[model samples]
Target: MKVIQSFIVLVFGLTVLVTNAQNKIKIEYKPEHPLKEKIEGQSSLNFDFIIENQSKDSLKLTRLEVSLFDKQNKLIQQKFLDNNGTAPSINTIPNIQWNSVSTNLLFNPFPDVNSMTDKLEYTFTFNDSIEIKKVVIPGDYEQATDFILPLKNKILVYDGHDFYSHHRRFDYEFTPIKQLGFTGNFMRYAYDFVVLNPEGKRYLNNGKNDTDWFGFGTDVLAVADGEITAIEMNQKDDKTFDIPSLKDKPLALYGNYIVIKHGENIYSMYGHLKNQSAAGLKVGDKVKKGQKIALIGASGSSFFPHLHFEVRNSINHQAEGLPSYFKNYNLILGSAKKEGTTHTITTGDIIQSK
Candidate 1:
């Protein structure tokens, strides 16, 4: 395995100061390195957009337009928004508050991925004046680290990083968690895995007990060779599928999880494990690529037994997510199975290590 040097970049919109006293606008985006993902066989780019009001005054965005350009500055994609026609219009950003939107760009003749760029233009009316601002968003793809399946069985990717997956759609705008030094969609490319029975369902009869799920208690392995930097094995596993209140408890989202540092600022997190499963493990412990580190369980915010896995830039929860590519795996969907080497896996994939 190759060690990826720390190169995570955070992109923010240009701050434009208005005539109003202490009024400014801020824009933020995730998956800082926008990679071209193959959606439905067409090359696509997905992103999350956020607009923040950094002052004590309200800001009403009257018009908004987003455009994508290639290396040659040729327009490849564009999005338009207005106060009317667009459903659920909420262009007004309250003082010190923020608004977010998620968009995807699909192109038949995909632009050169190396130098593609995005531009955001907005018209705002504030302090009795109409101001127009345009910010050029520039970024490139981040190098993906080669990883292996964390679980040792033919598993189902119940929910992986897709356009609509909670992992990709979650916007960490909560002030409490942000104030606690935790922010960012660290699980942007995360995976939730479960094992299916012969009937193509997640569990067997009744499905009430964690024991009924095939994935429960299964050993979770290290995705790569690294030193364990953090461990949380005390959080009790949920007995049922009811979602727990994770308010103000940032760490609870990953109950009984483990963090392993693979390289400079490169870490892999395995979350929602059975309590005490990693009882003998502690920080600073060295683990191999296939070493068993914990057991899959319904813990924290999880509604059922599953393994939540992700590769991130930092060991902490406030870091940016890094894309993951697996080696020697078979992605099976229905009767069609595709063998992959160094390939990106998506939702609904029945994966088996080759």
Candidate 2:
């Protein structure tokens, strides 16, 4: 995580007063860890920058440009920040306050290197008046590791059915955890599987009782064979609309969850289970794939009964989310029915276990 920063004062006009005004605007950048090294193709890097205005008048930012260089100092690519169709224009900045902006840059065809030890340069234009350039941000890039699907022969309820699923709907990008911080897995690629009846409804009859939910008390099976690394079984199931706040109990975010280490730096997490359903299991216990581990429930921070499933790189939620494919599942996308192994399911797709 080595970082190199530089402060440059660029003066385009001959007027001393204008030079002093340009100096009042300061720009600082913070690059994510992997960007410091060489990044692999199809991977993305994030950049965080702090823009400050020190002058008496407001500062308006109009455009930004980023340049990437190879190890030989050759210009690889140049990119302009695009905010939809129009160039990104920052609101007038009040004096003496810092404004933070971040960008996620994707490298399509990354340079051929084991590790990137090059530099990324940035140029910012303020109100079309002057250009501020900063160079020599140190970082490298590496190839991204591809993850395999860990689950087999398990039915993710909404796979072949449709109902109101929340952040865990796989393709639903507006997840609460993704909004928390810049780093960590934070349920970004997690999926929530809620039971739905044949009528495409989540509950039956009046829905007064928890049993009225279609998938309530259904067996939550192990996605892959692995030793149990962590388990939390004491949390109580919440009544509809009575889900507890995570502020009161932090771990309640994944009430009665289980973590299974499937491989080195790879783990599977099953969250929001029925109370005491996993009481028989202990850490270090070996479980087989498709084995029943717990029952789906509306525990922790859930609004209804569902299974929260995710493939993460680490045992904790702070790790990066890994993409996974399922083995032997039937995917029904409207009128089409595709059945096979290595199936990737997204939001609103009806999936059934083969």
Candidate 3:
């Protein structure tokens, strides 16, 4: 299956400086495939572009410039990456080094930063062409963390017992009720293959039944320890259920939420809970494994009652998601054609709790 329509991976941690000799600024930007044309608002893509000076003499350059664009060669507006958009990284090393580095010689014409990888037929002004590169970086999954299951062993049962539940993101067609592009932007990935008792949807279908559906929504618990950093609870009436509006709004104050800094650069999100569920989850409040963080219900931005879950490197607070594997879980491969890299999972496997 074709995996990418386009990708603009804004990998952080590049060094930039300006040289006094030629009076040029050093630059670095995250590498992406270049076909991607959209800039998601409040997305988790941490863009780290830097400028620095690397000359035999110190440079007192007073001016800097930057621009962004999409694959259509259309200029893109990045409201966040301003001239002072970012700050210097804390240097534990005694020798200080700027975070941005430019390999191109000084006074070389600067890149538009907005141009996509596919659109570079020529460097419009220079004989040189533009090319973006990717660098390998270690992930923080190696860091210790914690998780709190809401329904306990019910939803994630097969995780320990079967392999079929190894599924991750589900391919979905847009529904009228969907709020974002891929439909709902909440936590569809977290619920992938985690068995949901159709009782919730069933109750909604029963003719004139007063019974509330069971799985429309539920309480989302922490998959690990962390303190609350940011929370967006308010939702719009027009947007599809379960999908919070892409734009920012007033905090609805649904119960509470805790963002524990499990390890370096890792954070988890649990949303759509009851009003009072966040009672014990104060900003600095500490919780343990299996400790109740919140209750399940259809509270904010939801159609049915269920939980939304995800894990990612939150150092810069971007939308990038990390693929996670729980300890002591089994898989049920959903094919007779199981072979190389085929994920095997079953329906009845009991995924033991951590």
Reference-based TM-score of each model: 0.73, 0.59, 0.40
- Cα lDDT over the full model 2: 0.56
Model 3 misplaced stretches (Cα beyond 4 Å): 1-143, 146-150, 156-211, 215-220, 230-258, 315-317, 328-354
C-alpha lDDT of residue 252 in model 1:
59
Tell me the tens digit of each residue's lDDT in model 1 across 243-338.
Answer: 233434444577778999999878898988999999599999999888899899877778889999887787555677766777777876677777
Give per-residue CA lDDT, model 2, range 1-354, as digits (tens). Answer: 122222222232335655776687766543223343111232233233445567666544565666877779888777654223443322211121224322221121122222343666777676565578867455433223322222322334443111222332222112353343223423434677776555557788887677888778888888778899889888788732222344333335787888888888777888888889985999999988888888888777676777888766675424555545565666655556677444335555556666
Give candidate 2's error at residue 168 in angstroms: 9.7
- Clashing residue pairs in candidate 1, if any? none
Model 2 residue 328 CA deviation (Å) reads 1.1
Worst 10 residues of 3 by lDDT: 122-131
lDDT of residue 322 for candidate 2: 53
Whole-model Cα lDDT of every candidate shown, in order: 0.65, 0.56, 0.34
Per-residue error (Å), model 2, residue 33: 7.2
Error of 1 at 98 (Å): 7.8
